[model samples]
Target: MSSREAINVISILGSDYSIKAPVGEEQTLLNATRMLNATLADTKRKYPTLIGDKLLVLAALNLCSQQLEMKQRHQEELDRYQEQVNATVDVISRTIGKN
Candidate 1:
């Protein structure tokens, strides 16, 4: 981390946002906001009738839904990996105990 401040100001959905992150992570935060704004813009375009709270809620829900699915998949993979590790440890323990 640099001695310099790691905060950045960006525009998202017509609002100015201040994001604080590691020194080199300003671009990543900016990119994330850009993606979010894009999502909001796309949602607004598809459902112009929706406004204010409704539009924001829909966009947030869409992102959350995708995030949850990804988390579930990652959890499944972690569970499989843990099972393998446990099996290997058990085999090694038994072999050692028999000696």
Candidate 2:
């Protein structure tokens, strides 16, 4: 997409945010922005002392937490596969040595 075509203005919590995203991804970006605004509104309503930046930080932390969890799970799977490969290699080496 062209640079100008990829830029869209998103409204969140009554604020206008200019975001650069693919043309077809405007809906996805808008949806995510809406979700963030809802989350901030809910937090403010539940806790009157919560501020905008703090709510945004909390949301960022939650996203980071999800990413880390996924990374850890992927790493565990990679480790398991490596162990299986090592075990197979050891078995083959032993059989060839015996022959």
Candidate 3:
């Protein structure tokens, strides 16, 4: 392990995992892991029978769904912004041609 690599122990779904990341990414990893743990904790509340691998899989699916939703929203926003930019550019081009 290099000196710049930070090893952090993050607990999720009652398990302790030592995850390594770049020193600068320590806080970001910690925050993401905490969110994952919280999602698993929510799953545990509704389904007490799920344990071990099943619970982990459920959490993964839930997180993936959330990620996909966010990406779609981001893409939609970007598309809207691009459309406005194109409209403004066209107006500028037309005004310049008239001059």
Query: Each prediction's TM-score against the native?
Result: 0.70, 0.61, 0.93
Task: List model 3 lDDT by residue over 1-99, tens digit each.
Answer: 999998999987667899999989999999999898888889899889999999989988999999999999999999999999999999999999999
RMSD value for candidate 1: 3.1
Q: Which predicted model would earn the best TM-score?
A: 3
lDDT of 2 by residue, 17-92 (tens): 7889876888898888877777677666766776667867876676667789999999999999999999999999
Give the alpha carbon lDDT tens digit for every residue of 3-91 in model 1: 65587889865678776788777788878887778888989999999877788889989889989999999999999999999999999
Best by lDDT: 3
Residue 90, candidate 1: how far off, in angstroms? 2.2
Report each candidate's C-alpha RMSD, comma-separated, in the order given: 3.1, 3.5, 1.0
Measured by C-alpha RMSD in angstroms, how accurate is candidate 2?
A: 3.5
Error of 2 at 2 (Å): 5.6
